[model samples]
Target: MRQTRRAIALFLLVCSILVPLPVGARQAAANPFAELGLPELAVTITDTAIEGAPAERTAGRYVLAVTNDSTAGAPPVVSAGVGFLQPPEGMTAADLIAFFATMATGPDGGASPVASPGAAAEMEGPPPWYYEVPLAGGIYALPGETAYTVLDLAAGEWVLWAEDPTAPRPPVAITVTGEAPANQPVPEADVTITMTEMAFALDQPLAAGPQIIALTNEGQQPHFLVLATVPDGTTVDDVLQLSMTFMDPSATPPPNLSFEQMQDIANTADLSAGITNWFSVDLESGSYLLVCFVPDQETGIPHAMLGMIDVVTVP
Candidate 1:
């Protein structure tokens, strides 16, 4: 009898080990894109140059994996914002570099006209060539960390560059050919943030945890989202007031809020009208302010000043 009981107990233990996990547990561990089989492009940014992008790709949705590896200076690049631009016909990468240089310093090497808020509005809009180009959204990543963003690209020649004007790196060019694959898998998003003219509309309230966000630009002009955590008792109006001082060198700082109190959580590159992108962010329970600082097409004033700021609670 003892021998028979031992044999039955061993069989039960083996059966327990062979049984599969529940469906929900398996789904959570699976890769989100495993079924779609999307091609991934790895982009690396260093202090001197950008690398690892292929010269050609099929025009379609792509997962851009960006990594920043700069360690050269005090306060090294914590986060690098990469931007994609489709230059107008007859323009070369060199011309785009020259334009960025002129925008940083004046044509005569004097202070940039954009440095003064009053002059920025007074001056005529960007050169005519600027209007012809299209702005595609890109991703941001911290130093030594990898971040991902899904970009649906059309057939064209695209230019990739560092979005920061103060640290302009040589831009790289890539030619996209063919149409995007049909029936692409749309990411399952926990929240959707829609960008309209000078405002942001959220589909649902946010919860504190990892979230996949779908960002869509339905507005007439280009826009981007920047989510930052502010100190307790800070309001959207206070953030707007502080932002104005950053834009205008002559404007006075707000008495209540200082720059040190705010911490940037997530940011996206400029996305033109009709562009949609998906990114992932993890937030702790707190108050976050979402603001867009992209300048208006006609007036140079940032959208945040025109009431494009909102405060949300993650509880």
Candidate 2:
């Protein structure tokens, strides 16, 4: 009887080890693209240059895996531009380099890329546009914070470059050679954030976890989502006060938490007016903020100041 009992116990233990885990008990998968059922274009970004970018790809729904491989320096940020760079008549290499440098400085205190000299006219407009994705190594450098942007690209020659002027790598040239891939099923969004001319509208707060957030642009201009975590006790007023100094340099900035204290998680690249796009993000539980920093073409004022800023809670 004792021997039969031992054998039965051992068999049960083995069966338990071999059996599959219950769906609810299994850990959630982390691949953002896989979870969303979208094709992925893995792109590695470093302080010097981008690597593993395909020279040619089929135009279609693609999730850009923009990984910030820079383990040092300021946190890295990247953006993609699709267009030909045609320097104006008789523009020198030195001039071209200077033009790129100026463009990299961003709009705040830098000269507009639209009006720069030399190759300032390099990028032809209308078809030319840029998109940005926020990467990890932020305030806390939280793991698995890789940024993603879904792009429905058309067949054409495209250019991808880092928005950070300091990155040493040259621009990458990509050719969209084939037809776009088939559309994938859109994942259900746990939280949907609607964006207007200069404001953000969300139905309610978000529960922390791997989540799909849908961004709908209902305004007349393009906008993007930057997910950031503010320090505990930080309020909307504190953010606004700091903004005053940013908008008007002469104004005494609030002594509240500056940019250094905030941790950026991810960003949804530019969503054109009337266009909607969704991306997957690992939402950690914390106090967060959503803002669109894109400046208005007419006023040159950041959309965040136009009431695009909002405090978000991820519990």
Candidate 3:
């Protein structure tokens, strides 16, 4: 299984660099939120707890502007999101915690958490409704980097937390009011990217500057978008090889080419299948990799391996 998984990862990595997702029916030009403006929420990420975060927000489409205020050096990356679970009938917090404690240390006393990517049932009860912004390249920020993502929340109670467990902040209790407020105007999308089963579609080239990426996922599984700037002189091929080394450590490393990660300008939390979310990002003229890292359920391979990658040039 491991060998097959590694090969699948490598193949998908190569295909992501070469192929583009198919285009689907284009969305209407009129921006729905342009007239009905949605709320803009501010979230501050501190080394300790997420400060200035609210316990409740109106359910609907909203923008989250995350600012990082960790001590100067590269702070540990933190993922921000709302996790909602429909606990089993009559289950209390203590019951759920005890169930999860078992998950923390399963029947055989192994340390593996019961739930993992693509394995939702391993969770104690019904999987939690997760609306999360995946950390860019798995890191929240560099020394002083800040970014934002848009999320669509349904009316419910959600538990909010940074990705790190050791962080000082206690889990935040958020109640997403079931009532969606009056629609407000949202800026027109500068670029729209559509996602499906391991593929993406873009109608036109992206232009440099602050742009909104309207992400529409049509697949049955969740997906997220990461726009990482490719440095000068580095080809997508080089990037793929570097990625392969990490996927399969036994594989030989690429000579002379150091695997330095590029900066990500924009990203989004995992969008449940058949959902659409839009986020704003600032882009300079350059080559970028639009990639998704969601692992496939059956194969345990990432969507990127299944060809969910593309080279985007912003002129």
Candidate 4:
């Protein structure tokens, strides 16, 4: 009887540990929110210029732009895009690298990847362009961007980067915030800034980082997003800070903004409906106008005249 009780107690004790689970495992299983808070992150896409881009890019250069920002949270991002094409026939991106690692020889005396010239020689395979679609951690396209995939991204501050083994060896580093962002996507964050029938329709304001400004089709018309900002060479303090506590709608673009400002408005025109696009920028907190240039170019009437402008705040 004593042995039986002892055995039973031992079995019950083991079962208790197994049934309740370890503190960490239980925490992981009970409610995911309690551990990671929420899987959602503040990831937004933009076409803004890369914060750290090498002036000249050629072979062995990297081009990167912010595809997504998780705000200031971590496990840094170390990733590459999937659209990298392999070298054909006998050569490859590796060959390109090998070609450069050695001394450049004259026609009389060349290097390892050299032997003769053929139809294949002129063809550099990947064409030195590693195309990539925007990327977001938690927020992703349901069908996925067919042209791109997730490459090895180490844990640290990282942004999307592309490498070319050709000439113009420039290095581009997209901004990757030094923090971790929500690992989930927010449907509401996918905003559509449409311009049609001379009216603007945006549910909320844009922050100072990255975002996706989608343009929908009312007709077969083209639309764009434009906002006002300080003139070029202006300091951050000179920026006109503005925000809509109640989501206002009367901001306007500055007169004669720089070429970059103009491009910022046009780059958001990624042509995949229902598929969100991404861009990143380090913008100053301020008030600005958002409008689209979807008007008939021949008619000389601005797209905003048809109602694509709205007010937004960055705080």
Candidate 5:
């Protein structure tokens, strides 16, 4: 099981570099929220640091544009997002950093355990502090790609980071004050995908080519979207069987189908409940497997195994 988990992680890391941007260009022509006149936060991730976060801003909706400027040799994948937390009065950013360090080490003063389908069920629950910090959804983009997401910031202290622990960069702290902007219009979406308990609901058929996708987490727990292209004649049952082999430690993985056989086209960071975000993607005409690997809060099983897996045809 440990080997299988490691193989999957390595596969994701490799896919981050090999996956082609669905959109042909590296940058988008305009901000999706440009018409709303919202503040635009330009976040650039390079080899050295994460740049463009302001020290303070008025509480309101803003467009977060994340650009990956890292070299091919640098970390090819970046998960940049905003995390909101309201610590007790008088708490400082340094205090929060210390808290994060403790969380990373777990209660045993050792490294935290990797989350897996088998191990998740054995856990009691996340630490109490986990609920205190809410992650605002962000982009999961590769080098040279720029992705956008809408952030509705409230008056509070928010931290922006790469969300990768091995990167060794400090989180950027922002103080949001004043009233939030009112009556902001939601950006138009080409297709809307709603996440519910152990299922995904699509408002319309997903067409081929570049289009804005709106993702809403209506489920009680957090969820994410991952779309990968599969060969012709592939079915949802085939995906389920492959995933089951990967999740089970005792089962031997099938030789015919492996993670390397699929091409991952889209991956989004986890979004908390009631949070809606948009991303743009373009896919070739083919069948793609949509699955969410988020573990269930109660059973620790991945949502994909519980009927969240589906094959959508892009025509």
Candidate 6:
């Protein structure tokens, strides 16, 4: 039968490209952890993959295989935190809990190996908002394993609530609508962007799809917000000399990462005093900048040359 109808249409196009996303089809964004690519505290889990639905905001290393079952085997207490982010029909829930206070967090379950600099929940509470780059080992988990360690976010509309905090009624929130570019965060006209001190004020424009760059570190120190994109115009001193040029495997550009390139990407994160960070991308406009560098050794200056830099547009 024509090779069984071309092998049943290539097995339904490889099950529609591997599949993974059913829990309501996912798309209620504004900061659903940048569609789940992560940022806004943390929530990574991997083991093989088979829990069920919910996970589509780009699905990067945001890991979440989680399938312990745990009913008679008992362990059903897998909670995660950070709130707000599920509004848009008219908006207003305190502006989506002030965009989930930049990544609030509560359970923390794991990952807290030392480095609690001062604790307000460890260096500037990501819970009522506050940060200057302090989310290193953000509430890790690993026991039977299902990973994700560091997180960085500040976009907006946030929400990363996984429950079992003794579970009774509500918990599995997960409303991280971040990443803007395609249609550019369609907030109608109220599109805002402000990061403070370290930088970012960029008035408006950005709604093509996936751009979510929202930071909020009230300032005091420790900050981070990387984000990358080159080619068009490319200047800001060549984007700070390509963000300190890193890629020298014994020179002569032996492996690849050199043309003086830099792209680890961090659109928003590493906050401290007042905490908040978020970085998303889906851009195509051109000449963008949001730098930081984080230096401060008493005053070595590096908050992107003390300005933090900002010149976004994204159409």
Which pairs of residues collide in model 2?
Answer: 48-169, 59-180
| Per-residue lDDT of candidate 1, residues 163-279 (tens digit) | 643343567788889998889878888999999998999999878888888999999887888777766677887776665553455877678776656655667777888888888
Least accurate 10 contiguous residues by lDDT in model 1: 19-28
State which candidate, 2 or 5, has the greater lDDT.
Answer: 5
Rank list by TM-score: 1, 5, 3, 2, 4, 6
For model 5, what is the alpha-carbon lDDT of residue 142?
55
Give the TM-score of each candidate: 0.79, 0.65, 0.67, 0.29, 0.75, 0.23
Candidate 1 residue 173 C-alpha distance from true site, Å: 0.6
**Candidate 5 segments whose C-alpha is farther than 4 A from its true place:** 1-33, 71-93, 102-133, 164-167, 240-251, 254-256
The true-versus-predicted C-alpha distance at residue 37 of model 3, in Å, is 5.1
The models' CA-based lDDT, in order, is: 0.66, 0.52, 0.52, 0.29, 0.63, 0.35
Clashes of each: 0, 2, 15, 38, 0, 55
Better of 1 and 6 by lDDT: 1
Q: Indicate which candidate wins on TM-score.
A: 1
CA displacement after TM-score superposition, residue 105 of candidate 5 (Å): 6.9
Give per-residue CA lDDT, model 5, range 1-315, as digits (tens): 233233333323322422233322354345656776767888877776777889998887778887777664433233333333444345665676565555445457666454444542233433333333555666655567666777677787766654443243456778889997668767789999999888889999999888888999898787777777777677877776666554455666555555556765667766778888777777789888888766567664567778887888888
Worst 10 residues of 6 by lDDT: 14-23
RMSD, one per candidate, in order: 18.4, 18.4, 9.5, 24.2, 5.3, 21.8
